[model samples]
Target: MVDAKDLSLAPRLLPISLSVEAGQVVHLIGPNGSGKSTLLELLSGLEVPQSGSVWLQGQPVSGQTRYDLAQVRGYLMQQQRPAFVMVVFEYLNLVLDSVQLATGEIRDKAVADVVSRLAISDKLHRRIDSLSGGEWQRVRLAGVLLQVSKALNPHACLLLLDEPSTGLDVAQQAVIYQEITALAREQEIAIIMANHDLNRTLEHADTVVVLQQGRIVSLGPPKAVLTDRLLSDVFATPLEQVSTANGPVIMRASSS
Candidate 1:
């Protein structure tokens, strides 16, 4: 669980407050530079807030050191490019080291489990730089999951993802969303993610927070927060939510 109150990050983000509970999936959606990423950074303790406070499970994030916070939350940024030459398995060993988990069959099993879940089992021996965009996304996500597993209570860990579905294709994006939902339901890991795909957010998010001009415009269920009027007003264009067999789809309004 996480909470933020009276949060301000200058022109990028105005004062805002929000809370996330265990087994919940909260989505932050807004236009470019609308403070989605800034909010995540604040919650993850990657950046100290200019004002307000972020609490993890009850304790103030400010009191926690960077390493201390890492144990409670796993964050995957929007842009993650491999900087050095390392194979997938080797990369995972580094993650395990940071978490202070032991290496051996135990670590091997952990890495295997994550890659298997993300369906990247064959890429363990491949270099990070050689992976396709989707493959790289899965690999990075696997590292985040690995970190959560090493937590004192994996189920209590918070997952903060910034556009996690960035490089994945449609099917792969669905897979990642499904995995996130499963993590919340089965593992009780609270997840807060920022995404540009409204439909995906609608399908998987337990709650949606709509931000505009660095302030919250609406926050509620997809149906309540993503109405025709709200979408049109927030985005400064005519928009509508159409109910289809699949689910609610946000679309541009027909001119006619």
Candidate 2:
């Protein structure tokens, strides 16, 4: 469980209180510079809040050591550009071994499992510098997931992801979302993912929180919170919420 009370980060995030239980996926959506990333950072203990407090599992985050907090939370930032060169497999191995004290075979198996799951097995031996944007994003995501899976208590872990599907195409995005959903369901990992793709978030998230200018304009189930009024108001643009054969969709409104 993660509880944040009146979290404020000055100009980036306002005082916001949120509670997340295990086995849930909460999607954060908003335009650029809306404090989506700031909130995730506070929850992950990466940044200290100016006025608020965060509690992870039952202890205050301020009191927990960095390593102690890291053992229970995994964070994936939106951008990562490696300065040093390394093969994809080597990089992933480093991440898996960070919090995992397993045997070599067990660690190797864990790395291979996530590599295959993200469909980046082909690039395992490839140099990280050679990977395309999408490829690197997948490898980074795989590393984050592997780190969380190696947590001291997997069932109590939390995953904080920012635009996790930034460079993936449609098919790859689907696979990543599926894996994320499974992690929340099967492993009971509480996940907070910030994404701009409304359609995908609606499909996979259990709850949606829409923020604008560091304020939550709406929060609830995707269908209930993503109305035409809500989307248009927060986005400052015309959007139509339509009921489609597949499900509900938010579409850009045609010019009048």
lDDT of 1 by residue, 1-256 (tens): 6889999999899999999998899999988888999999999988988899998888999867877887788899886776789999888777767767656777677777778878899998999999888899898998887787633334346999999998888888878888899888887889999989988877889999999889998999987888899888887889999989887798999999
Q: Give per-residue lDDT, candidate 2, residue 66.
A: 65
How much lDDT does each candidate structure score? 0.86, 0.86
Backbone N/Cα/C clashes per model: 0, 0
Q: Over the stretch 1-256, how does candidate 2's per-residue lDDT look in tens digits?
A: 8899999998999899999999889999999999999999889887888999998788888866667776788889987888899999889767756665455666677777888989999998999999999999999998888877733335347899999999999999998999899889988899999999999877888999999999887889998888888889888999987789998877999888
- Model 2 error, position 187 (Å): 0.3
List the candidates' TM-scores in order.
Answer: 0.94, 0.95
Total clashing pairs in model 1:
0
